[model samples]
Target: MIDRPRRLRATPAMRRLVSETRVHPAELVLPVFVREGATEPVPISSMPGVVQHSLDSLRAALVAAAEAGIGGVMLFGVPEHKDAIGSGATDPSSILNVATRVAAEEVGGALVVQTDLCLDEFTDHGHCGVLDPLGRVDNDATLDRYREMAVVQAASGSQLLGLSGMMDGQVAAVREALDDAGFTDTPILGYAAKYASAFYGPFREAVQSSLVGDRRTYQLDPANRREGAREIDLDVAEGADIVMVKPAMSYLDVLADAAASSPVPVWAYQVSGEYAMIEAAAAHGWIDRRRAVLESVLGIRRAGADAVLTYWATELAEWLR
Candidate 1:
């Protein structure tokens, strides 16, 4: 009884004094969706309070993110046009790139502006890469597209490119392309351990994902923990400035493994499904929304994420402040 643990829980001040982990505003990044040709913000049905922003709305969101003191904002584009090759992804005037420019201009000095460097949102078939003649996802060809995308995204003045395509040789390809294009200083935030998860259901709606069957051909299998680490290792070796383990709540082991081994910073994504679950429970009065949100993000940070990407970034930053 001499080493009673309850003693530390005796008061709020005592609990804070012995706290092992803390969440900070600077460690949170907001993921925002910007739609092409929309005059007004569009609400995502599955995700309450989240909106697909128009150009004006996106700028406002960037300003809010800067004011909230969040570390950065990640941009995803919902283009009005889609094609077989995902041509919009590499186009200079593409929605994602244009939005990146706007975000950078609005908050360049205040926060890091990151663009989603993937073709899934821009392609008609909903695949992350182009299809081969036999219909398989062409890994090598996709790396070529990614190489083009890196320069386009870099030209938009983005501080980081969120390489979420999960393609083979993607990091090296993009790094080489950027360096060759004189964008050697732009960092790459590789989605190293992204899993093909059921939890991505809400995300398909968020980006208007064009996926048909699944991203299993490229994304990591959810059951393989060691493979996730291997992906992180490969990415780091190929010059990824930061590595991420996605769907943070379900992949803490992977996140922890990456953080332990990575030479650079490790990040975790508190994905759409994770946010929706908490919101749904809170709406039904099953959980305290604020407390649950704080706990979920804090758990990610404690699991060894140097930073976290979450829909709740702005609100969480406010709460922490």
Candidate 2:
């Protein structure tokens, strides 16, 4: 008789028993945006239900994330002002810092509070780091800003810093700064394999980015798989407790490579554009929203991701439980 694979797929109980990758509430981390001076949450048009939150709204979201049993929340701040050097990023009184303090006060240690230590949202040019006179991203100078920003974020009680700036030597620089400031326990989540991709379109709108040009100068090129591994290696050697691949769906190859080789935990960011694609298609009745969402995340997890960052973290946690 011919072998029949259908035997294993015949029952839900059998399918559940053999499932290789699982998504848990504690493995999901929510990414949230808090805009300065907003009295009410501002809905991002391109992103459908996602909002740029006011302080009050942000507090509410933090509480929701904790209640949903999400392991962490990654915070991004939309400042009312921007400058050449992204000055607000390092300012103690900056909206991002203020929001971090608020999150820490609200959630305490019940959930890990993470902050984006990138200059993109705060910089007028919308680049991830400071630019020099020639208009190119100045890596060394940006590392200095990262160092100061690390101390301030640690002071604001962020348990993990999402280092998304893509600056060379940034991980080591920030780690040194944190240690020198008596923040020995603070951890770094390095966005080691972030790529310069068109998939970040929705994120630009969500953050109200002022970018006039592409970030190809600093971010990893999508075509280079080996380069991604090299970057992950550098981050790990520089003390990144956790390493991540951004725009996760398109970069699963890179994610798997890092996960296979790295000693530390590997993370993947199911970025804004990915969320919008599924939501937009589902809204059009082209796909089953619930099933598609679960399948997408499951695929990523099966590709060797330890945890995933998703905009639907809260809702998925509820569904997963």
Regions of candidate 1 where Cα sits further than 4 Å from its true position: none
Question: What is each predicted model's overall lDDT from 0 to 1?
Answer: 0.94, 0.94
Q: Which ten residues in a row have the lowest lDDT in candidate 2?
A: 1-10
Instruction: Estimate the overall C-alpha local distance difference test score of candidate 2.
Output: 0.94
Q: Which prediction has the highest TM-score against the true structure? A: 1
TM-score of each: 0.99, 0.98
TM-score of model number 2:
0.98
Q: Give the per-residue Cα lDDT of candidate 1 at 281.
A: 99
